[model samples]
Target chain A: MTIFTNFFYSFMASLFFALLFNAPKRSLPVTAAIAGIGYVVFILITQNLGSKPLGFFLATLIMGLLCEIAARVLKMTTTTFVTIAVIPLVPGLGIYRTMQFIVQNNYEAAVQIGIPTLLAAGTIALAIAISTFAVKLFLHFWQQ
Target chain B: MLNEQEINKIIKIVKLEAQIILENGGETYRVEDTVMRICRSFGLIDVEPVVIPTGMFITISHDNLATHTIIKRVRRRTVNLSKIDAANLISRQLTTGRISLDEAIIQLEQIIGDKSKPKILTATASALSAGFFTLLFNGSLFDFFIAALCGAVIQLFSFLLQGEDMSNFIISLTGGIFTAVIAITATQIFNMGNMDLIISGAIMPLLPGLAMTNAIRDTIQGDLVSGVARGTEAIIVAIAIAVGVGVVLKTLILMGGGLN
Candidate 1:
């Protein structure tokens, strides 16, 4: 139940974000659905595995792979799908909370929240890079 | 069978295509690849393109006769994936010999001249995105409304200021201030809504997630210069938003306004 609701909210949010970014009209729903599923997987991993970085990494890996496949099928630029679909996992809340803790003069709590935020962001980036490389390698081998 | 004048013409057209891609949030490597593909299709085999976050340089040599290079500076960048898609399509068609040079030029111009969606649609998008994000953050229905209002106002504020000569840092700073002020005030006056949830949800759209992703992608592709530049951009925008929201929140704290 909770997972479904999370998916619903994230799906709606990413759909509107795709609109805000002016993605091609035909690919809007597809990218938004990818984002929603990616975020839900992130939540599930975090809840069960108790590892936030792993969650971020896996979620972005899935999103990036989906976006690449979608780009091939739709014949659009891969960045179009990758950029919009990754927004929901951006750690906006972590950044905000870190700022809030700093403003409240709690450096200890600020650092606690800040380091994880940076780590999570780095993990997400690495996952995207890996996915792109994986796809390129697959194509290279398949073509030969 | 290509004359110097025709080579020059192809150079200009290819330059314009690359410029449009870079200026409209396309990746640096994508710009380079597109330039190479387009130039190759036009019979300019010896083509080299160097693209960074801020500019692009393309050099082409024709049969050992002469080398021509064009350096284009790209100052303003905003997210509009439709333009990137259109440009991508044009380059694909050109490479496949499905379109003439003249037709490609016409299509590229139409894409460059095309306007984004209406302001109202963008604003409504911001509203709904922020509103739904609030729910994702466990905010109540009331908080969703508050965050939606903050998101709309901030979107409009930035939209109005986008055409000005102001820097992006200033705009993001002002947006942060606006988000904090509005969320805090709405929560205080109405005596409802979670301030933390509203603030976080409202700032979601302003984060530099795309920049960070692009930075990593560029780095992995060995475009280290562009990767570092985009990484800096992402860090700066993140800091600006944090400082803006922090300053406002700190001021309220000093005034003894409990952030309940």
Candidate 2:
């Protein structure tokens, strides 16, 4: 599929999730747009560079930074945007597949899929944390 | 110049605000920070809050004396980002002196009483998200419809089971089973949609994405206890979902039904 198609799918996915999570109604468009862009970036990086972790890290970092900015500008907690934005890249499929392999008694396939999945999850988390911390540091320096 | 009753009121206000945030998917560290800020705004120094996923313990002292501690056991948690945002805004306004204690209480009560999202909205949101997710995962149009149906079924089932006092594990496990069953039945009967895509897409709504993200956020902010607690919660929910899906898949296999 084209990048635009991917972006559309990602946008719709995030939009409805924002609704499900009961995010502030007004912020739905902004949150979904950011999540869509982030997921597309992940797909592009992963496809071109052949590094899933790098893709996850970069995508989340960008998403996290944008979300923190949006939160501050919108006067909401960072969690509101960050949580919704990360939903698209949360590796749910990997977790599901790993469990599928495990239940099939396919340990080798399970481990093969599981390790990367866990690593990707970790990378996404670390990137988000870094982005959050970076924003805090920037605010601190501005205050000083 | 604060009297005993006023101090008591401040303590109550802080506790209520923290409870709202925690119960509505605010991170533990955010809860702690907001609690401390509110207490400080009320001229209560020496505040310490220990917040885990399930409960909170907070102590606030005035002038290094006259300590008040409150323990709140949070038994139910759902993902409502709006509530967290509202609580955060209220606390910010309180700290900035833009809203008085009584005003804050009124606002917090409004949040507590606010039940705006109906069941149909949630079910629809689940359907759309699952359907779009299937498309993202390269599922065909047929699979999208099947996944959407499964999503709605899972959401309705979960809503039906909401007041049963079941654990998160059981709820998610049941949700997963429902998703797999619906996806499998729909795909197998029609033999049009991709079962794998439908199952994965439908299960997306049930995954513990928020828990895992919050766990990492909590840990990075030095809330090790909450971090560990939420991390374990995430793992448990994930495993429960896996088991739920696995059980259905295993049953289908035993019955010699082709999952393909």
Candidate No. with top TM-score: 1
Pairs in clash, predicted candidate 1: none
Please list all clashing residue pairs in model 2, or write none if there are none.
none
Error of 2 at B233 (Å): 0.6
lDDT by residue for model 2 (B49-68), tens: 99998899998777634878
Error of 2 at A76 (Å): 0.7
Worst 10 residues of 2 chain B by lDDT: B160-169
User: What lDDT, from 0 to 1, does candidate 2 have?
Assistant: 0.87
| Model 2 lDDT at residue A139 | 92
Worst 10 residues of 1 chain B by lDDT: B160-169
Per-residue C-alpha lDDT of model 1 across residues A38-80, encoded as one tens digit per residue: 9999999999999988899999999999999999999998899
State the DockQ of every prediction: 0.85, 0.79
Instruction: Give the alpha carbon lDDT tens digit for every residue of B1-260 in model 1.
Output: 78887787688778878878998898899999998888888777898899998998889998856899999988888888889988898889988989887788888888888775689999999988988888899889999999899889888888877756556777788879999999999988998889999999999988888899999999999999999999999999999999999999999999998765
